[model samples]
Target: MIEVLGENFIIQQIRDFEDSQFEQTFSGIDKATSNIKNIFESLANKSCKIVRYKKFKQKILNRKPWVDHEVRDLKKTIKPKGAKLRQEPFNLELKCNFFTHAEKL
Candidate 1:
């Protein structure tokens, strides 16, 4: 699984910080300076989570051998174009075409 911070949750966290007056913690500091410091601390802290996602290794492993080989070849073709096909967003029709092509191969 690939893990990364969730941007949406982070934004919500910032909103919560504003709502909760979390910045009040540094009230002793100069108002302008404290606001800047609070902003920095909010971004730097563990208020965010590491989101996990399944990497393509599991997907390829779960497929039939021939289908997996076709996937690998498709990956090779996209490699020259700078990314894996699996990383691209696919709509229903495109996904159907991909599976159809894999089954044909």
Candidate 2:
């Protein structure tokens, strides 16, 4: 009877150790998953910024001709009023509608 009790105690101890190890492993995996999620989020933000800059640049380039014409018209209109003619490069606002729509993911 004593030998049977000793064997049962050893079996219980081994089961407990296995359960502890499994819990530790699962916790480590959760931490790794969280870290990966953060890294991906940072990467997504960088990509969005790059795309926004590219689109802003393209729009400015497209408007070059219209901007020149508008400036010429403005100068002609203001010349009779004795106003000084001035021209400057304007920064265009690039709306991230697509990025905002996809933010849910």
Number of clashes recorded per candidate: 0, 0
The prediction achieving the highest lDDT against the true structure is: 1
Best of the candidates, TM-score = 2
lDDT of 1 by residue, 8-51 (tens): 65566556556653344456346646655666565666555558
Local distance difference test, each candidate: 0.54, 0.45
- Consecutive 10-residue window with the lowest summed lDDT within model 1: 1-10
Backbone clashes in model 2, listed as residue pairs: none
Instruction: Report the lDDT tens digits of candidate 2 across residue range 49-98.
Output: 45434344334544455567756666555443332212322322112322
Estimate TM-scores for all models: 0.20, 0.24
Q: How far in Å is the alpha carbon of 82 misplaced in model 2? A: 40
TM-score of 1: 0.20
